[model samples]
Target: MKNKQLTFFLMAALFLIPMQVKAEQVNLYAAGSLRAALGDVAKAFEAEIGNQVATEFGPSGLLRQRIEQGEAAHVFASANMEHPQNLVGQGQKGPVALFTRNNLCALAQPGQTVTTATLLDVMLDPAVRVGTSTPKADPSGDYAFELFGKADQLKSGSTAILTAKALLLTGGPDSPKAPEGRNLYAWVMDEQKADVFLTYCTNAVLAKKELSGLQIISIAPELSVGADYGLLVLDGASQEAWRLALFILSPEGQKILGDYGFVVGGLPAKP
Candidate 1:
């Protein structure tokens, strides 16, 4: 009876050990734009590797600021290559893979008919209310500003229209006072609150189903800019974090990113 009891206890221990191990969670920080695509990858990764991945999503610029301020995140994914490189330059060394590339797009609510021939056209149309993140805090916002600058140069007389557009798109209720809402572009897209918003191509792809009433229009002159998703393991990340980062930049990871409409590049581009 004693021998039988001991064996049963041993069996139970063995079962519980792996269960506990599987329950270990890795923390990942990603840009808000990557929420949909990463959700799929996280689900698949957990199933395949038997590990849990907890994700924090936000603007890449904000994530960089957090890391610089000594925030505790194991894996970091940035919306731009520059942020990851900045992290690496600051001595956080790891593989920086360009998991995706996104262009600027103007998204409008469903049934909102507007041909955005010029940035002025997009801004001036009283029927088209615009929204965007604060350029000072978010790269998307910065890009939006660049778009406006270019527009202002091309169409000088439309400054008031652009100013009005800025006011219209400036903030949501949850926006912070300083930087405002840099990542809320998707919320506007999802809720149909604003007629137009500037957001990433990947975001548009992910929301294509839910935002059936919205349309994505390309920005002319290409803005000569694109957002690249990059992954890095911080200086003192755990083994699990390293593994998660590795898995995210792997071919399997790139494939998942592609499925979400991200243009995955094998290596980070030269600035």
Candidate 2:
């Protein structure tokens, strides 16, 4: 009887030990723009590895500030290279990978017909409103500013006109939220706050998918700008964090980003 009882206890311990081990969770911080694609990737990774991924999504700069303030996060996925390189500069030794690229686009409000040729003109109309994310806090806004600068080159003083008329609506602490909807941009448009917004093509796609009657006006190549996304694992991160970072850098991960409308190829070589 004593031998049988000892064996039973040993068997129970084996079951409990692995369960406890699998309870470990990986914390990941990603740019708001990556939410849809990364969320799916995280789900797959968790199922395959038997671990949980807790994600925090926000503007790249805001997320960077959180990490710099010592907020508990293992991986940082940024909308641009600057924030991650800043982390590496501060002593986090990790290979910075350029994982994806996104281009600027104009998301027009419902029934607002516009083409690439007429994009700047439509936005410039005194009657039409324009929305943009906050500069410095969100790379999307910075990209918009660059496009505006290009417009200035096309027509002298156009940049100042656009800047003066533009509304800084997204990316900061006062960023707008979707009305219990899947697409955040749709809600902003529904509010009639702006007739159009300058953001990434990927984000515009997301908005179109979630809302009907939205038109995406491509930016002409001559005046177009693209954003490069960066990913890195901070020093002192858990083994799980490192694993996730590697998984995201893997080819399989690149496919996920591509499916979400990121330009998968033609990026700088991965580190």
Collision count for each candidate, in order: 1, 0
lDDT of 2: 0.87
Error of 1 at 107 (Å): 0.9
Off by over 4 Å in 1: 1-24, 89-91, 116-120, 125-128, 157-164, 167-193, 222-224, 266-271
Residues 1-271, candidate 1, lDDT per residue (tens digit)?
A: 9999999999988887845344568888888778778877888889888888989877777778888998888888887777888888888776687666777777777666655565457566776677776664466766666666666566675645665566334322245432243234445666556677776766665555554656877777634346656778887777877778777777777788877777775545558
In terms of TM-score, how similar is model 2 to the real structure?
Answer: 0.88
The CA lDDT at 155 in model 1 is 66
Clashing pairs in 1: 110-213
Q: 157, model 1: CA deviation in Å?
A: 5.7
| Residue-wise C-alpha lDDT for candidate 2, range 1-271, written one tens digit per residue | 9999999999998887855455578899999999999998898789878779999998999999999999988899999999999989988897888888889999998778688999988888999999999888999998898889999878888899998998999898778766654577777776777898999999998888877778888999878999999989888888988889877877777788889998885335668
Model 1 global lDDT (CA atoms, 0 to 1): 0.70
Model 2 steric clash pairs: none
